[model samples]
Target: MSIPNEALQKILQEIGQKKAFAEQQLAIVKQQMAVKTRENRMLQLTASEVDSLPGDTNVYEGVGKMFVCTPIPDVQKRIASESEEINADMSNLQKKQDYLEKTYENSKQSLEQVLRGGGS
Candidate 1:
């Protein structure tokens, strides 16, 4: 038995929707990754700059609208921790991007097959 024309159209439409949704999600994930990567880079640079300063030099960390005087070692530790968190976030986003890419490809393939009269 073969799928009726109406049902086939519906199937095709559904696949198309899935493909579009996946594309949107992939774009968002990429944007998020970019932001996180930039933040991580800045943190790395700040850590390096802070490390070069004399131990006696005062360091300030931004807290809300004010900069709170903090120790060099404390600033370094905070930067390191923030970098780690951003790295983890980027890794998770990468995994999600991979999955969305695969999903989009599969949807495209299925849509092509259906359009070519190869789908049941």
Candidate 2:
């Protein structure tokens, strides 16, 4: 059966809209990943600084170090969790984008086939 031009155009438009939405989502995910990475780096730097302080120099150095390092583990864990989440989100987004691209290509090919009187 041959598809109408109006139907084909509508499908193409819908595909374009979906593709644009996916691109937007990917951009936001990228921005979120960047922010999370920066936060993780800052946490690591603070942890390293705390570890580098001299315990014998200050009477409260031990307490300071312990206090600082206490939440380091939690922060590290959170960073890892966030990183994993971001990776999963990006992977899923890429998969969706790939599928949409393939769909667009297939639709275009089908439209071409219809136009060429080779409907199947």
Candidate 3:
């Protein structure tokens, strides 16, 4: 059966709204992925730098809002642990980004189909 113009317009509008929302979500996911990637890189670099330092090297680590004096050995261990956590976070965010990309593509395709009057 042929669809009514009003119903088709309504379907197109809903698809347009969903498409816009999905685009925003995708943007947010990308921003979060970038932040996670940066954190992962910095953690790796910090761990590498700490590894190269002499065992007697003096270093301070941030505890919450303040940097506390910590022994080089302790700093090294903390860096190693933090690096692992950051890597895990990066992996999770990567997966999330992949999912979001797929969702964004589907939303775009749906919008295109609706615009072409291929309402479902």
Winner by TM-score: 1
Clashes of 1: 0
* Candidates in descending TM-score order: 1, 3, 2
lDDT per residue (tens digit) for residues 24-77 in model 1: 999999999999989998998998899899999998888899999999988888
* Per-prediction tally of clashes: 0, 0, 0
Candidate 3 pairs with clashing backbones? none
- Candidate 2 residue spans exceeding 4 A from truth: 56-120
Better of 1 and 2 by TM-score: 1
How do the residues 83-113 of candidate 3 rate in per-residue lDDT, one tens digit apiece? 7887787788778777777877887887787
Candidate 2 TM-score versus the reference: 0.50
Regions more than 4 Å wrong, model 3: 64-66, 118-120
Compared with the true structure, what per-residue lDDT tens digits does model 2 show for residues 7-45?
866765765666566566656655765665676566567
The alpha-carbon deviation from the true structure for residue 115 of candidate 1, after best TM-score superposition, in angstroms, is 0.4
* C-alpha lDDT of all candidate models, in order: 0.92, 0.59, 0.78
lDDT of 3 at 10: 87
The candidate with the higher lDDT, 2 or 3, is 3
| Between candidates 1 and 3, the TM-score winner | 1
